[model samples]
Target: MGKRYTVPARQGLAVRLKKGEQVRVINTHGTQVVDSWAFNAADPTEFMSMEHMRQGINGIIPKPGDGLMTNKRRPILTFLEDTSPGIHDTIIAACDIWRYRNLGVEGYHDSCTDNLRMALVAIGFPVAEVPSPFNLFMNIPVRPDHSIGWEPTVSKPGDSVTFRAEMDLVYAVSACPQDIVPINGAGLAPVDAHLEVLAEA
Candidate 1:
Protein backbone atom coordinates (compact mmCIF):
# COMPACT_ATOMS: atom_id res chain seq x y z
CA MET A 1 0.00 0.00 0.00
CA GLY A 2 1.17 3.57 -0.64
CA LYS A 3 -0.02 7.09 -0.01
CA ARG A 4 0.25 9.49 -2.93
CA TYR A 5 0.72 13.26 -3.02
CA THR A 6 1.37 15.69 -5.86
CA VAL A 7 3.38 18.94 -5.67
CA PRO A 8 3.20 21.59 -8.34
CA ALA A 9 6.07 23.92 -9.23
CA ARG A 10 6.82 27.00 -7.06
CA GLN A 11 4.67 25.41 -4.34
CA GLY A 12 5.86 23.91 -1.08
CA LEU A 13 4.89 20.43 0.10
CA ALA A 14 5.97 18.54 3.22
CA VAL A 15 5.74 14.86 4.11
CA ARG A 16 7.13 12.77 6.95
CA LEU A 17 8.97 9.66 5.88
CA LYS A 18 8.49 7.11 8.60
CA LYS A 19 11.33 4.64 8.82
CA GLY A 20 11.05 1.98 6.12
CA GLU A 21 8.61 3.82 3.88
CA GLN A 22 9.71 4.27 0.29
CA VAL A 23 9.07 7.58 -1.47
CA ARG A 24 9.03 8.11 -5.19
CA VAL A 25 9.25 11.42 -7.13
CA ILE A 26 7.73 11.40 -10.57
CA ASN A 27 8.43 14.03 -13.20
CA THR A 28 4.98 14.10 -14.73
CA HIS A 29 6.07 16.42 -17.55
CA GLY A 30 9.30 15.97 -19.46
CA THR A 31 12.25 18.40 -19.02
CA GLN A 32 10.94 19.69 -15.70
CA VAL A 33 13.61 19.81 -12.94
CA VAL A 34 13.57 19.54 -9.16
CA ASP A 35 16.17 20.51 -6.55
CA SER A 36 15.82 18.82 -3.18
CA TRP A 37 17.36 18.73 0.31
CA ALA A 38 16.81 16.40 3.27
CA PHE A 39 17.38 16.61 7.02
CA ASN A 40 17.06 14.37 10.03
CA ALA A 41 13.66 14.84 11.63
CA ALA A 42 15.39 15.05 14.98
CA ASP A 43 17.85 17.75 13.90
CA PRO A 44 17.08 19.65 10.73
CA THR A 45 20.50 21.25 10.40
CA GLU A 46 22.36 18.03 9.87
CA PHE A 47 21.80 18.12 6.13
CA MET A 48 22.96 16.11 3.17
CA SER A 49 26.15 17.02 1.27
CA MET A 50 26.70 16.35 -2.40
CA GLU A 51 30.40 15.62 -1.89
CA HIS A 52 29.72 13.25 0.96
CA MET A 53 26.81 11.80 -0.93
CA ARG A 54 29.02 10.95 -3.90
CA GLN A 55 31.78 9.61 -1.69
CA GLY A 56 29.50 7.55 0.51
CA ILE A 57 27.93 6.02 -2.54
CA ASN A 58 31.42 4.88 -3.64
CA GLY A 59 32.46 7.99 -5.60
CA ILE A 60 29.79 7.21 -8.11
CA ILE A 61 27.56 9.97 -9.42
CA PRO A 62 24.06 9.62 -8.09
CA LYS A 63 21.69 7.53 -10.12
CA PRO A 64 18.98 5.06 -9.29
CA GLY A 65 19.88 3.05 -6.15
CA ASP A 66 22.35 5.68 -4.90
CA GLY A 67 21.96 6.65 -1.24
CA LEU A 68 22.10 10.28 -0.14
CA MET A 69 24.15 10.53 3.07
CA THR A 70 23.95 13.18 5.73
CA ASN A 71 26.82 15.29 7.11
CA LYS A 72 27.09 12.92 10.05
CA ARG A 73 27.59 10.01 7.68
CA ARG A 74 24.11 8.69 8.28
CA PRO A 75 21.94 7.55 5.46
CA ILE A 76 19.16 10.04 4.98
CA LEU A 77 17.61 8.70 1.83
CA THR A 78 18.36 5.95 -0.64
CA PHE A 79 17.83 6.35 -4.38
CA LEU A 80 15.78 3.25 -4.97
CA GLU A 81 15.00 3.84 -8.64
CA ASP A 82 14.86 6.33 -11.52
CA THR A 83 12.82 6.23 -14.72
CA SER A 84 14.55 9.16 -16.41
CA PRO A 85 17.50 7.91 -18.47
CA GLY A 86 19.57 10.92 -17.29
CA ILE A 87 19.10 14.23 -15.48
CA HIS A 88 21.09 17.53 -15.62
CA ASP A 89 23.81 19.67 -13.93
CA THR A 90 24.84 17.93 -10.69
CA ILE A 91 28.24 19.55 -9.98
CA ILE A 92 27.67 22.92 -11.62
CA ALA A 93 25.79 24.02 -8.48
CA ALA A 94 22.95 26.47 -8.05
CA CYS A 95 23.24 30.03 -9.38
CA ASP A 96 24.74 32.72 -7.16
CA ILE A 97 26.97 35.84 -7.19
CA TRP A 98 29.74 34.18 -9.19
CA ARG A 99 27.28 32.87 -11.74
CA TYR A 100 25.56 36.21 -12.30
CA ARG A 101 28.89 38.05 -12.67
CA ASN A 102 30.30 35.42 -14.99
CA LEU A 103 27.20 35.31 -17.13
CA GLY A 104 27.47 39.11 -17.54
CA VAL A 105 24.04 39.47 -15.97
CA GLU A 106 23.37 42.63 -13.96
CA GLY A 107 23.29 40.80 -10.62
CA TYR A 108 21.72 37.97 -8.70
CA HIS A 109 18.14 39.04 -9.14
CA ASP A 110 16.86 35.44 -9.10
CA SER A 111 18.46 32.17 -8.02
CA CYS A 112 17.85 28.73 -6.60
CA THR A 113 18.27 30.16 -3.09
CA ASP A 114 15.51 32.62 -3.78
CA ASN A 115 13.19 29.85 -4.87
CA LEU A 116 14.15 27.72 -1.87
CA ARG A 117 13.47 30.65 0.43
CA MET A 118 10.02 31.05 -1.01
CA ALA A 119 9.30 27.37 -0.60
CA LEU A 120 10.45 27.47 3.03
CA VAL A 121 8.26 30.46 3.80
CA ALA A 122 5.27 28.64 2.35
CA ILE A 123 6.04 25.59 4.51
CA GLY A 124 6.28 27.68 7.71
CA PHE A 125 10.07 27.40 7.99
CA PRO A 126 12.13 30.53 8.49
CA VAL A 127 13.70 31.45 5.17
CA ALA A 128 17.12 31.82 6.82
CA GLU A 129 17.08 28.22 8.00
CA VAL A 130 16.69 26.60 4.61
CA PRO A 131 19.44 24.05 3.94
CA SER A 132 21.49 23.26 0.87
CA PRO A 133 19.65 21.03 -1.60
CA PHE A 134 20.17 18.05 -3.82
CA ASN A 135 19.67 18.78 -7.49
CA LEU A 136 17.43 16.00 -8.71
CA PHE A 137 17.07 15.40 -12.45
CA MET A 138 20.03 17.75 -12.98
CA ASN A 139 23.07 16.51 -14.87
CA ILE A 140 26.57 18.05 -14.84
CA PRO A 141 29.00 15.68 -16.44
CA VAL A 142 32.76 15.64 -15.99
CA ARG A 143 34.77 15.40 -19.17
CA PRO A 144 37.55 12.86 -19.66
CA ASP A 145 40.10 15.52 -18.74
CA HIS A 146 38.42 16.22 -15.37
CA SER A 147 36.67 19.41 -16.41
CA ILE A 148 32.91 19.72 -16.02
CA GLY A 149 30.33 20.87 -18.50
CA TRP A 150 26.75 21.84 -17.79
CA GLU A 151 24.75 19.59 -20.06
CA PRO A 152 21.18 19.50 -21.27
CA THR A 153 18.64 17.54 -19.30
CA VAL A 154 18.83 13.80 -19.73
CA SER A 155 15.25 13.38 -18.51
CA LYS A 156 12.36 13.24 -20.87
CA PRO A 157 8.64 13.63 -20.26
CA GLY A 158 7.15 11.38 -17.61
CA ASP A 159 10.45 10.26 -16.11
CA SER A 160 10.62 9.56 -12.36
CA VAL A 161 12.73 8.26 -9.50
CA THR A 162 12.06 6.40 -6.24
CA PHE A 163 13.82 6.71 -2.87
CA ARG A 164 13.50 5.22 0.60
CA ALA A 165 14.01 7.20 3.74
CA GLU A 166 16.56 5.54 5.97
CA MET A 167 15.32 7.43 8.98
CA ASP A 168 12.61 9.83 9.96
CA LEU A 169 13.34 12.77 7.64
CA VAL A 170 12.12 16.15 6.45
CA TYR A 171 12.68 17.21 2.86
CA ALA A 172 12.25 20.35 0.73
CA VAL A 173 12.22 20.65 -3.04
CA SER A 174 12.11 23.33 -5.73
CA ALA A 175 11.91 23.32 -9.51
CA CYS A 176 15.11 25.25 -10.34
CA PRO A 177 14.99 28.79 -11.85
CA GLN A 178 18.46 28.59 -13.42
CA ASP A 179 17.82 29.91 -16.91
CA ILE A 180 21.30 31.41 -17.18
CA VAL A 181 22.78 28.09 -18.20
CA PRO A 182 22.15 25.20 -20.54
CA ILE A 183 20.54 23.16 -17.77
CA ASN A 184 17.29 24.98 -18.26
CA GLY A 185 17.98 25.39 -21.98
CA ALA A 186 16.68 28.94 -22.54
CA GLY A 187 14.25 29.48 -19.66
CA LEU A 188 12.78 28.19 -16.46
CA ALA A 189 9.92 25.74 -16.85
CA PRO A 190 7.55 24.21 -14.35
CA VAL A 191 8.12 20.64 -13.21
CA ASP A 192 5.47 18.41 -11.67
CA ALA A 193 6.61 16.07 -8.90
CA HIS A 194 4.48 13.33 -7.32
CA LEU A 195 5.32 11.55 -4.08
CA GLU A 196 4.04 8.22 -2.84
CA VAL A 197 4.70 6.54 0.51
CA LEU A 198 4.97 2.79 0.27
CA ALA A 199 3.57 0.40 2.79
CA GLU A 200 5.91 -1.34 5.23
CA ALA A 201 7.86 -4.07 3.51
Candidate 2:
Protein backbone atom coordinates (compact mmCIF):
# COMPACT_ATOMS: atom_id res chain seq x y z
CA MET A 1 0.00 0.00 0.00
CA GLY A 2 1.18 3.54 -0.63
CA LYS A 3 1.82 5.97 2.20
CA ARG A 4 -0.45 8.96 2.30
CA TYR A 5 -0.23 12.19 4.26
CA THR A 6 -1.77 15.62 4.32
CA VAL A 7 0.17 18.87 4.14
CA PRO A 8 -1.57 21.66 5.92
CA ALA A 9 -1.88 25.18 4.65
CA ARG A 10 1.34 27.20 4.41
CA GLN A 11 3.30 24.15 5.45
CA GLY A 12 5.81 21.85 3.76
CA LEU A 13 6.94 18.23 3.52
CA ALA A 14 10.05 16.24 2.62
CA VAL A 15 9.79 12.77 1.16
CA ARG A 16 11.94 10.15 -0.52
CA LEU A 17 11.16 8.05 -3.58
CA LYS A 18 13.00 5.08 -4.95
CA LYS A 19 13.37 4.49 -8.65
CA GLY A 20 10.06 3.29 -10.21
CA GLU A 21 8.05 4.48 -7.26
CA GLN A 22 5.36 7.07 -7.91
CA VAL A 23 4.32 10.04 -5.82
CA ARG A 24 1.00 11.76 -6.25
CA VAL A 25 -0.03 15.22 -5.11
CA ILE A 26 -3.75 15.76 -4.62
CA ASN A 27 -5.68 18.99 -4.34
CA THR A 28 -7.99 18.03 -1.51
CA HIS A 29 -10.50 20.84 -1.82
CA GLY A 30 -9.32 22.37 -5.03
CA THR A 31 -7.96 25.36 -3.13
CA GLN A 32 -4.19 24.88 -2.84
CA VAL A 33 -1.01 25.01 -4.91
CA VAL A 34 1.76 22.47 -4.33
CA ASP A 35 5.23 23.78 -5.05
CA SER A 36 7.55 20.83 -5.58
CA TRP A 37 11.32 20.51 -5.93
CA ALA A 38 13.57 17.50 -6.39
CA PHE A 39 17.24 16.57 -5.86
CA ASN A 40 19.47 13.75 -6.93
CA ALA A 41 19.80 11.46 -3.92
CA ALA A 42 23.40 10.53 -4.65
CA ASP A 43 24.58 14.09 -5.25
CA PRO A 44 22.27 16.87 -4.22
CA THR A 45 24.19 19.35 -6.36
CA GLU A 46 22.66 17.87 -9.52
CA PHE A 47 19.05 18.78 -9.02
CA MET A 48 16.22 19.33 -11.46
CA SER A 49 16.82 22.29 -13.78
CA MET A 50 13.56 23.64 -15.12
CA GLU A 51 15.44 25.55 -17.78
CA HIS A 52 17.19 22.52 -19.18
CA MET A 53 14.15 20.32 -18.85
CA ARG A 54 11.91 22.78 -20.67
CA GLN A 55 14.42 23.41 -23.39
CA GLY A 56 15.00 19.72 -23.88
CA ILE A 57 11.28 19.13 -24.19
CA ASN A 58 10.93 22.23 -26.36
CA GLY A 59 7.93 23.36 -24.35
CA ILE A 60 7.25 25.61 -21.42
CA ILE A 61 4.73 23.22 -19.84
CA PRO A 62 5.45 19.54 -19.44
CA LYS A 63 2.94 16.87 -20.32
CA PRO A 64 2.53 13.26 -19.30
CA GLY A 65 5.47 11.05 -20.29
CA ASP A 66 7.77 14.07 -20.29
CA GLY A 67 11.06 13.35 -18.57
CA LEU A 68 12.19 16.22 -16.36
CA MET A 69 15.92 16.80 -16.54
CA THR A 70 18.65 18.14 -14.29
CA ASN A 71 21.21 20.90 -14.71
CA LYS A 72 23.44 18.22 -16.20
CA ARG A 73 20.60 17.49 -18.64
CA ARG A 74 19.94 14.04 -17.24
CA PRO A 75 16.44 12.74 -16.71
CA ILE A 76 15.41 12.61 -13.07
CA LEU A 77 11.65 12.19 -13.07
CA THR A 78 8.84 11.44 -15.49
CA PHE A 79 5.31 12.74 -15.57
CA LEU A 80 3.43 9.46 -15.30
CA GLU A 81 -0.14 10.60 -14.98
CA ASP A 82 -2.13 13.80 -14.74
CA THR A 83 -5.79 13.72 -13.79
CA SER A 84 -6.06 17.48 -13.99
CA PRO A 85 -6.00 19.37 -17.27
CA GLY A 86 -2.22 19.86 -17.00
CA ILE A 87 -2.52 23.59 -16.53
CA HIS A 88 0.62 24.27 -14.48
CA ASP A 89 3.28 26.96 -14.63
CA THR A 90 7.06 26.75 -14.86
CA ILE A 91 7.73 30.38 -15.77
CA ILE A 92 6.76 31.89 -12.44
CA ALA A 93 9.21 31.78 -9.58
CA ALA A 94 8.03 30.62 -6.20
CA CYS A 95 6.75 33.38 -3.93
CA ASP A 96 9.26 35.07 -1.62
CA ILE A 97 9.73 37.94 0.84
CA TRP A 98 10.92 40.45 -1.79
CA ARG A 99 7.82 39.79 -3.90
CA TYR A 100 5.42 40.44 -1.05
CA ARG A 101 7.30 43.60 -0.14
CA ASN A 102 7.04 44.86 -3.69
CA LEU A 103 3.28 44.36 -3.51
CA GLY A 104 3.26 46.96 -0.69
CA VAL A 105 3.06 44.35 2.04
CA GLU A 106 5.98 43.87 4.39
CA GLY A 107 7.28 42.03 7.46
CA TYR A 108 7.85 38.37 6.67
CA HIS A 109 4.71 37.01 5.12
CA ASP A 110 4.66 33.24 4.58
CA SER A 111 6.32 32.17 1.31
CA CYS A 112 7.08 29.11 -0.82
CA THR A 113 10.82 29.68 -0.77
CA ASP A 114 10.86 29.66 3.02
CA ASN A 115 8.66 26.57 3.12
CA LEU A 116 10.83 24.74 0.56
CA ARG A 117 14.00 25.58 2.44
CA MET A 118 12.57 24.32 5.68
CA ALA A 119 11.16 21.18 4.14
CA LEU A 120 14.30 20.29 2.18
CA VAL A 121 16.52 20.47 5.27
CA ALA A 122 14.64 17.51 6.68
CA ILE A 123 16.12 15.48 3.82
CA GLY A 124 19.67 16.91 4.32
CA PHE A 125 19.64 19.50 1.50
CA PRO A 126 21.08 22.96 2.10
CA VAL A 127 18.74 25.90 1.96
CA ALA A 128 21.15 27.94 -0.15
CA GLU A 129 20.85 25.67 -3.20
CA VAL A 130 17.08 25.44 -3.35
CA PRO A 131 15.78 25.47 -6.91
CA SER A 132 12.69 26.96 -8.45
CA PRO A 133 9.76 24.57 -8.04
CA PHE A 134 7.35 22.89 -10.45
CA ASN A 135 3.95 24.27 -9.65
CA LEU A 136 0.99 21.86 -9.81
CA PHE A 137 -2.66 22.86 -10.29
CA MET A 138 -1.67 26.46 -10.88
CA ASN A 139 -3.72 28.00 -13.68
CA ILE A 140 -1.50 30.43 -15.57
CA PRO A 141 -3.02 30.91 -19.02
CA VAL A 142 -1.44 32.73 -21.92
CA ARG A 143 -3.76 35.07 -23.77
CA PRO A 144 -3.74 35.54 -27.52
CA ASP A 145 -1.73 38.70 -26.97
CA HIS A 146 0.84 36.58 -25.11
CA SER A 147 -0.05 38.19 -21.78
CA ILE A 148 -0.62 36.02 -18.73
CA GLY A 149 -4.02 35.35 -17.24
CA TRP A 150 -4.67 34.79 -13.55
CA GLU A 151 -7.52 32.31 -13.68
CA PRO A 152 -8.68 30.47 -10.59
CA THR A 153 -7.92 26.76 -10.39
CA VAL A 154 -9.78 24.55 -12.83
CA SER A 155 -8.97 21.35 -10.96
CA LYS A 156 -11.75 19.66 -9.07
CA PRO A 157 -11.43 18.22 -5.60
CA GLY A 158 -9.41 14.98 -5.62
CA ASP A 159 -7.61 15.92 -8.83
CA SER A 160 -4.00 14.74 -8.85
CA VAL A 161 -0.79 14.40 -10.81
CA THR A 162 1.56 11.49 -10.26
CA PHE A 163 5.26 11.30 -11.07
CA ARG A 164 7.64 8.39 -11.33
CA ALA A 165 11.08 8.93 -9.89
CA GLU A 166 13.63 8.17 -12.58
CA MET A 167 16.27 7.90 -9.94
CA ASP A 168 16.48 7.69 -6.16
CA LEU A 169 15.46 11.16 -5.06
CA VAL A 170 14.61 13.55 -2.28
CA TYR A 171 11.57 15.74 -2.92
CA ALA A 172 10.02 18.65 -1.07
CA VAL A 173 6.69 20.38 -1.39
CA SER A 174 4.98 23.47 -0.06
CA ALA A 175 1.28 24.27 -0.13
CA CYS A 176 1.39 27.80 -1.50
CA PRO A 177 0.06 30.52 0.86
CA GLN A 178 -0.70 33.34 -1.49
CA ASP A 179 -3.98 34.60 -0.15
CA ILE A 180 -3.70 37.96 -1.87
CA VAL A 181 -4.53 36.39 -5.22
CA PRO A 182 -7.25 33.95 -6.25
CA ILE A 183 -4.66 31.41 -7.28
CA ASN A 184 -5.18 29.11 -4.37
CA GLY A 185 -8.90 28.52 -4.61
CA ALA A 186 -10.45 31.69 -3.20
CA GLY A 187 -6.93 32.60 -2.02
CA LEU A 188 -8.39 33.97 1.24
CA ALA A 189 -7.03 31.05 3.25
CA PRO A 190 -4.92 28.12 2.22
CA VAL A 191 -5.99 24.51 2.71
CA ASP A 192 -4.54 21.04 3.05
CA ALA A 193 -3.34 18.68 0.27
CA HIS A 194 -2.55 14.99 -0.03
CA LEU A 195 0.87 13.56 -0.85
CA GLU A 196 1.29 9.88 -1.41
CA VAL A 197 4.17 7.52 -2.13
CA LEU A 198 2.79 4.61 -4.07
CA ALA A 199 4.55 1.35 -4.67
CA GLU A 200 5.24 0.19 -8.21
CA ALA A 201 2.22 -1.44 -9.75
Candidate 3:
Protein backbone atom coordinates (compact mmCIF):
# COMPACT_ATOMS: atom_id res chain seq x y z
CA MET A 1 0.00 0.00 0.00
CA GLY A 2 1.62 3.23 -1.20
CA LYS A 3 0.46 6.80 -1.60
CA ARG A 4 1.14 8.11 -5.11
CA TYR A 5 2.49 11.44 -6.27
CA THR A 6 4.05 12.88 -9.44
CA VAL A 7 7.17 15.08 -9.85
CA PRO A 8 7.98 17.12 -12.93
CA ALA A 9 11.51 17.95 -14.05
CA ARG A 10 13.43 21.18 -13.10
CA GLN A 11 11.28 21.03 -9.98
CA GLY A 12 11.68 19.03 -6.74
CA LEU A 13 9.67 17.38 -3.96
CA ALA A 14 10.37 15.83 -0.56
CA VAL A 15 8.81 12.83 1.17
CA ARG A 16 9.52 11.10 4.47
CA LEU A 17 9.44 7.32 4.52
CA LYS A 18 8.55 5.84 7.85
CA LYS A 19 10.24 2.58 8.71
CA GLY A 20 8.73 -0.39 6.86
CA GLU A 21 6.82 1.84 4.48
CA GLN A 22 7.37 0.88 0.86
CA VAL A 23 7.85 3.53 -1.77
CA ARG A 24 7.92 3.23 -5.55
CA VAL A 25 9.26 5.46 -8.33
CA ILE A 26 7.63 5.20 -11.73
CA ASN A 27 9.24 6.19 -15.02
CA THR A 28 6.18 7.40 -16.81
CA HIS A 29 7.97 7.70 -20.15
CA GLY A 30 10.72 5.60 -21.66
CA THR A 31 14.32 6.73 -22.26
CA GLN A 32 14.17 9.48 -19.69
CA VAL A 33 17.07 9.32 -17.24
CA VAL A 34 16.87 9.87 -13.49
CA ASP A 35 19.67 10.34 -10.91
CA SER A 36 18.72 9.21 -7.41
CA TRP A 37 20.15 8.82 -3.92
CA ALA A 38 18.95 8.12 -0.37
CA PHE A 39 20.07 9.21 3.09
CA ASN A 40 19.41 7.93 6.59
CA ALA A 41 16.85 10.10 8.30
CA ALA A 42 18.64 9.50 11.57
CA ASP A 43 22.26 10.01 10.50
CA PRO A 44 22.17 11.59 7.03
CA THR A 45 25.75 10.42 6.58
CA GLU A 46 24.55 6.83 6.19
CA PHE A 47 23.85 6.85 2.48
CA MET A 48 23.35 4.47 -0.42
CA SER A 49 26.44 3.30 -2.27
CA MET A 50 26.82 2.69 -6.01
CA GLU A 51 29.73 0.34 -5.41
CA HIS A 52 27.88 -1.57 -2.73
CA MET A 53 24.73 -1.75 -4.83
CA ARG A 54 26.71 -3.12 -7.80
CA GLN A 55 28.55 -5.63 -5.65
CA GLY A 56 25.33 -6.75 -3.97
CA ILE A 57 23.64 -7.16 -7.32
CA ASN A 58 26.75 -9.16 -8.36
CA GLY A 59 27.66 -6.94 -11.33
CA ILE A 60 25.17 -8.98 -13.36
CA ILE A 61 23.19 -5.86 -14.19
CA PRO A 62 19.92 -5.09 -12.41
CA LYS A 63 16.30 -5.35 -13.47
CA PRO A 64 13.03 -4.49 -11.77
CA GLY A 65 12.37 -6.01 -8.26
CA ASP A 66 16.08 -6.06 -7.55
CA GLY A 67 16.87 -4.84 -4.06
CA LEU A 68 18.89 -1.64 -3.68
CA MET A 69 20.64 -2.62 -0.46
CA THR A 70 22.93 -0.78 1.89
CA ASN A 71 26.53 -1.68 2.65
CA LYS A 72 25.35 -3.15 5.95
CA ARG A 73 23.14 -5.57 3.99
CA ARG A 74 19.96 -3.77 4.91
CA PRO A 75 17.23 -3.57 2.28
CA ILE A 76 16.79 0.06 1.38
CA LEU A 77 14.36 -0.48 -1.44
CA THR A 78 13.11 -3.14 -3.89
CA PHE A 79 12.34 -2.87 -7.56
CA LEU A 80 8.59 -2.73 -8.23
CA GLU A 81 8.67 -6.01 -10.17
CA ASP A 82 7.48 -4.74 -13.47
CA THR A 83 5.94 -7.12 -16.01
CA SER A 84 7.95 -5.24 -18.65
CA PRO A 85 11.71 -5.29 -18.29
CA GLY A 86 13.16 -2.43 -16.18
CA ILE A 87 16.40 -0.97 -17.54
CA HIS A 88 19.03 0.74 -15.35
CA ASP A 89 22.52 2.12 -16.00
CA THR A 90 25.42 0.39 -14.31
CA ILE A 91 28.47 2.43 -15.51
CA ILE A 92 27.60 6.00 -16.35
CA ALA A 93 28.39 8.37 -13.48
CA ALA A 94 27.22 11.81 -12.57
CA CYS A 95 28.58 14.57 -14.82
CA ASP A 96 31.73 16.50 -13.90
CA ILE A 97 34.62 18.41 -15.51
CA TRP A 98 36.25 15.35 -17.12
CA ARG A 99 32.96 14.36 -18.66
CA TYR A 100 32.44 17.87 -19.98
CA ARG A 101 35.79 17.77 -21.77
CA ASN A 102 35.20 14.22 -23.02
CA LEU A 103 31.85 15.18 -24.49
CA GLY A 104 33.60 17.93 -26.55
CA VAL A 105 30.90 20.24 -25.33
CA GLU A 106 31.63 23.79 -24.29
CA GLY A 107 32.64 24.52 -20.70
CA TYR A 108 30.58 22.66 -18.08
CA HIS A 109 27.37 24.67 -18.22
CA ASP A 110 24.67 22.32 -16.86
CA SER A 111 25.29 19.25 -14.68
CA CYS A 112 23.82 16.59 -12.38
CA THR A 113 25.62 18.04 -9.38
CA ASP A 114 23.88 21.33 -9.91
CA ASN A 115 20.52 19.60 -10.00
CA LEU A 116 21.35 17.64 -6.89
CA ARG A 117 22.49 20.71 -5.04
CA MET A 118 19.21 22.40 -5.87
CA ALA A 119 17.25 19.35 -4.69
CA LEU A 120 19.08 19.28 -1.36
CA VAL A 121 18.37 22.95 -0.81
CA ALA A 122 14.70 22.37 -1.55
CA ILE A 123 14.63 19.64 1.11
CA GLY A 124 16.49 21.72 3.74
CA PHE A 125 19.64 19.57 3.76
CA PRO A 126 23.19 20.87 4.03
CA VAL A 127 24.36 21.77 0.51
CA ALA A 128 28.00 20.84 1.15
CA GLU A 129 27.25 17.28 2.18
CA VAL A 130 25.51 16.12 -1.00
CA PRO A 131 26.99 12.80 -2.04
CA SER A 132 27.52 10.90 -5.26
CA PRO A 133 24.29 9.35 -6.54
CA PHE A 134 22.82 6.32 -8.29
CA ASN A 135 21.87 6.70 -11.92
CA LEU A 136 18.56 4.97 -12.62
CA PHE A 137 17.38 4.16 -16.17
CA MET A 138 20.64 5.21 -17.83
CA ASN A 139 22.54 2.27 -19.36
CA ILE A 140 26.32 1.92 -19.24
CA PRO A 141 27.40 -1.64 -19.94
CA VAL A 142 30.91 -3.04 -19.72
CA ARG A 143 32.08 -5.11 -22.65
CA PRO A 144 33.65 -8.56 -22.45
CA ASP A 145 36.91 -6.85 -23.44
CA HIS A 146 36.58 -4.65 -20.33
CA SER A 147 35.51 -1.52 -22.17
CA ILE A 148 32.35 0.44 -21.45
CA GLY A 149 29.67 2.04 -23.59
CA TRP A 150 26.32 3.66 -23.06
CA GLU A 151 23.51 1.26 -23.87
CA PRO A 152 19.78 1.52 -24.44
CA THR A 153 17.54 1.81 -21.42
CA VAL A 154 15.84 -1.39 -20.15
CA SER A 155 12.70 0.35 -18.92
CA LYS A 156 9.65 1.67 -20.75
CA PRO A 157 6.71 3.88 -19.90
CA GLY A 158 4.71 2.98 -16.78
CA ASP A 159 7.44 0.73 -15.34
CA SER A 160 8.19 1.12 -11.64
CA VAL A 161 9.99 -0.31 -8.56
CA THR A 162 9.17 -0.24 -4.86
CA PHE A 163 11.77 0.48 -2.17
CA ARG A 164 11.00 -0.35 1.45
CA ALA A 165 12.99 1.95 3.68
CA GLU A 166 14.61 0.02 6.49
CA MET A 167 14.33 3.17 8.59
CA ASP A 168 12.98 6.65 8.16
CA LEU A 169 14.72 7.93 5.00
CA VAL A 170 15.02 10.88 2.69
CA TYR A 171 15.69 10.73 -1.05
CA ALA A 172 16.80 13.20 -3.70
CA VAL A 173 16.17 12.59 -7.36
CA SER A 174 16.83 14.43 -10.59
CA ALA A 175 15.70 13.57 -14.10
CA CYS A 176 19.12 13.55 -15.76
CA PRO A 177 20.43 16.27 -18.03
CA GLN A 178 22.56 13.87 -20.03
CA ASP A 179 23.08 15.28 -23.51
CA ILE A 180 25.84 12.94 -24.50
CA VAL A 181 23.86 9.80 -25.43
CA PRO A 182 20.69 8.19 -26.71
CA ILE A 183 19.72 7.04 -23.24
CA ASN A 184 17.95 10.36 -22.81
CA GLY A 185 16.95 10.95 -26.43
CA ALA A 186 20.49 12.08 -27.18
CA GLY A 187 20.02 14.63 -24.42
CA LEU A 188 16.88 16.08 -25.95
CA ALA A 189 13.99 14.74 -23.89
CA PRO A 190 13.06 15.15 -20.24
CA VAL A 191 11.93 12.48 -17.74
CA ASP A 192 8.87 12.31 -15.50
CA ALA A 193 8.74 10.30 -12.24
CA HIS A 194 5.89 9.39 -9.92
CA LEU A 195 6.37 8.43 -6.28
CA GLU A 196 4.03 6.51 -4.01
CA VAL A 197 4.20 5.87 -0.25
CA LEU A 198 2.58 2.66 0.90
CA ALA A 199 1.09 1.69 4.19
CA GLU A 200 3.11 -0.67 6.32
CA ALA A 201 2.09 -4.32 6.12
The number of the candidate with the highest TM-score is 2
lDDT of 3 by residue, 1-201 (tens): 455776675344456678877777777776666777777777776777667778887864566667776656665765555534655664556765567678798775466677777766776774456555667666777779989777657777876766667778877677766666666765566666777778876
Cα lDDT of model 2 by residue, 1-201, tens digit? 387888889988989889888899999888678888888888888888889889989998899989999989988989889988788887778899987898778688989998888888766766567677888888888889999976678888999999999999887889988888778866467888999999976
Clashes of each: 9, 0, 13
User: Candidate 2 regions off by >4 Å?
Assistant: none
Error of 3 at 63 (Å): 4.6
Ranking by TM-score: 2, 3, 1
What does candidate 1 score in Cα RMSD to the true structure?
Answer: 3.0
Tell me how many residue pairs clash in candidate 3: 13
> Which is the winner by TM-score between candidate 2 and candidate 3?
2
Off by over 4 Å in 1: 1-7, 10-13, 86-90, 127-132, 186-192, 197-201
How many Å off is the CA of 26 in candidate 2? Answer: 0.5
The TM-score that candidate 1 achieves is 0.80
TM-score of predicted model 3? Answer: 0.81
Candidate 1 worst ten-residue window by lDDT: 88-97
Candidate 1 on 1-201: residue-level lDDT in tens? 376677666444556677777777666666656777776777767777776777787764676667788888878988878778855334546555566778887844556666666655665554345455667777677889988776657777678877888888766666665665666444555555676778656
